[model samples]
Target chain A: MYGNSQFDGSAAFSGGGFMPSQAIPTADPSSPAKSREAQGLLPLTVKQIREVFQASDDKANFLIDGVSVNNVKLVGLLFEKTERVTDVSFVLDDGTGRIDCHRWVQESLDTKEMELLSNGTYIKVHGHLKGFQGVKQLVVYSVRRITDYNEIPNHVAECIYVHCYNTRTRKMQDAPQATGQLPNPAVNTPSKGYQPTSSNHSQFSVQPIVDGMKGIDKIVLNYIEQPSCIGKENGIHRAELAKQLNVPEHKIMEAISSLESEGLIYATVDEFHFKSTVNG
Target chain B: MDTSNPAAFVNAELLRMYVGRRVRAVIQVLRNDGGSIFGKSTDEQELVVKGHPPNPPTTFVEVIGIADSNRSIQAEIWTNFGDNFDVSSYNTICQLANGDFKHLFI
Candidate 1:
């Protein structure tokens, strides 16, 4: 339940991971071209960055959690600051692990930005990941000191969010094959219609869905499916549900009606109350 | 210093799990007495931080060191996290790093 969870938005966060990775058409002949295309900036912790492996044949590509990653970002304490004639480097630690990050001073702006960092200051680094003789380091493109402390936790949450979105969704995609269930085409047809056009990670990060329904519809359904909500005589009233979710009365009504039509939920006591059709 | 073992993020509760091991935490300074700091953990539990305070004492400080005891940390590295910080958010990070998302961290 959201009440005792570490993050109130974690339900929404995990929902993003449920989007079928197969939604992206992989059958296209342009597999190599698609793989070469730029991936969205991946938010990762230093520990996860260390776990990434370089592609066997190509030195350019990197993979984390069995998926390719690019343009990674992290927030950490700037522990060691080194300024050289050609480039400036820093050792950043975000508690999980430490990583060496460097930015080439190609112009005055680069030097100016790098000068703003000092040891013990928290900074956000946006850069590419590179492996130098089997050691991983971040090739810093942009670095900014974190003035607002909230960015620290926000970065951690984002890392976990992307981690789940990449790894969990991939597991779900591979689950049927691993279990010897060779592609249930009958059940997969309807879910294909709901796939988004863009495969960008950030686009679907907040859009949590349930049984092809989204937004308030999904939230209401999930709330009713909670262990406590099942098998109740009257179930939960629309007024109580709306009050609990802090949504307007009409929006709850809309979600209930939509969910009812989809057969995910049914009217239990009169038209105003509802419960999930799935049993306890 | 080959990183076979690394410091983990810990709050007051998790610090107990890492006794005599390396850990890191953000503490809101309650009192500073030159060599030692009396601070409150992100989870709002009191902790003694054994380290030198930064010049012009920051309200929030992150200490990376060994968890000496459940209620104390022996600081090796000190970072000034400025006067204002979102303690609740930091608390959430502590929970996630040690809880459901533990594998993502060291």
Candidate 2:
């Protein structure tokens, strides 16, 4: 019963009428046909993409192959509120020389894939095509962050290479390749002992150089409630300090540097000690 | 800038009150050689006029408390008629105030 030539990629059941095999027979008989279909679908590499387009009918589906996709949009929903997946949407670029994508849902999304979707995170998606709002798009059923060779399968690795190469070419076109040369000053002599810092510091002090500097008054007032942070013992690193105050690191550093220069605080390599009025 | 008009008088005082509360108000500076004047208040609050002018000029106007169906407090200002004014200046001053004070001036 097993060695029949008629089983050419299609399954014929024992029933008299032939049921066109909906999916490839796996070792487990209970697996859903949709899952099998998802596994069978091939992953498209980024290099193969020329453009992406939004499906007109289903705002969620995107057409990548230059053909109009009339289907539902693919969306992944997560129940757990995780930082990585919140407030993120992905656009799938099919290798067709366009940017075709769809906005699937209004509610916030959370998923494992979102963690890898951060800036500079690379990932691969495996999903089935679904039509939403008259557009055909991939609904990711499974996704994995791309890592070095050992982690990814061979086929997936090839796809990643193709994608990376295409992305590099596109980036090059956007920014001209630099020739890396020094400016020529054959006629004019280089200026000697030009101290630009004095003038620069004056202007910097007059205006708030940092984008999101919290006012010194506000900081002093708010610090009262958090008494544990009273002294230099609780001094946080520049990055951590910025995050706590919801300001940029450079701004915090600038504020500290200014206060230190003014003799208001004692500055060391890593921390600044707020001067106690009682000492005076 | 006709300070003679009662509406102009009320608006000028309201502007001072707004600024005292750190709220900004926009007023059109109209000059017909005499003085600058304003008409119409941005907010609606009752004016409690007390004491005559020029005798140390102490006037206190309380913003009448009127709660609407939505539970939002309404402020109304009262002024006598006949003052020529501009509305655009008041709108600008409201914007200059922080986002929190916009409703107060508005």
Candidate 3:
């Protein structure tokens, strides 16, 4: 039996489906490698593809407006088609810009798909972004001629929506969460170099409750744990907490109730105000 | 030869600014007279495309060429988009590509 194996025989474990917050790893889940693996195909324009910048010291980690992008879906006019012995290369022009794209000749099906496309054919390509000699290009996974004319406009709309989400909307939503994550046990210890003994003591006391909480609950707890909230005897008001989190009052109420049930927070002054049990 | 300058996506109105420059527009062919095409732009404005029109004109065609005037284009390329094209969606893209998101394009 492979009972002792790391992968084991957990046939029921659905990797792509929902998992409870507690089961999810609490560490920096958005590590560049992990986030890249989790990011699905980003619908992007040829201009955005050309504009992607190397985000980290590692040359391979590319980002479009701070959003990690790996696989991408593009719709454009196939301008030039060339067939080499092992790969088919073409240039795609989407009106915004043009970029070189290539697909490997792996099978008869690939060659057949390549044969269907010619110069000036509108096509949809799903591919990975790659850099060769400082020039960005696509290593295509699948290419299909766009039979439906609506797909062109649809692709444009999709790319704009994705662009806004990556550059503006998602960043606004993630700002508080990024600050909230600084107090994580894994990240807190090293930063408290001057007071290691006190940091370790607090870490041990807070680790269990912090480990089980996530998302809005973790954010609410972190806000309550702030020195300003903890120093006051009345704690912070529910309205203030809701405003700080930019979430609906009902959602804050739900998170507060869940945290209270777990004994991580306690009412102070009145039921309207709450403080973290560990630090307050 | 003209590959150095990218063809900007333009509507009947946007075409005015790019006079004598490369532009692309999808137009619903209203009439074809062999050497020229009289069509309606995605924005529903009339446009004259001077080039060899498609032998059997489709409902819609995308023309890429130099904007000769405010209402006319000297087409260098014509792509036959089959019948049943969505004009409204293309209209929205034209406005977005030239307006708020102009920086995204060349």
Candidate whose lDDT is highest? 3
- C-alpha lDDT of residue A9 in model 2: 40
**Best-to-worst lDDT order:** 3, 1, 2
Error of 1 at A87 (Å): 1.8
Listed in order, each prediction's TM-score against the native is 0.67, 0.20, 0.65
lDDT of 1 by residue, B41-103 (tens): 988899999978776569998888989999999999887888888888888888988899988
Clash pairs of candidate 1? none
Over the stretch A59-159, how does candidate 2's per-residue lDDT look in tens digits? 42333332222221211112122242224345532211112232223243434345445422324455444445543334443444444312222332333
Candidate fnat values, all:
0.53, 0.00, 0.47
- For A153-204, candidate 1 gives per-residue lDDT tens digits of 7888878866665565556555321111111122222222122224332113
Give each candidate's interface RMSD in Å.
2.6, 31.7, 3.6
Which portions of model 1 miss their true places by more than 4 Å?
A: A1-29, A32-37, A175-249, A252-280, B1-5
Worst 10 residues of 3 chain A by lDDT: A177-186
Best model number under DockQ:
1
Per-model lDDT: 0.72, 0.31, 0.74
lDDT of 2 by residue, B20-80 (tens): 1211122222211222122123443322221121221112211222222121222232111
Lowest lDDT block of 10, candidate 2 chain A: A178-187
Cα RMSD for predicted model 3: 12.0
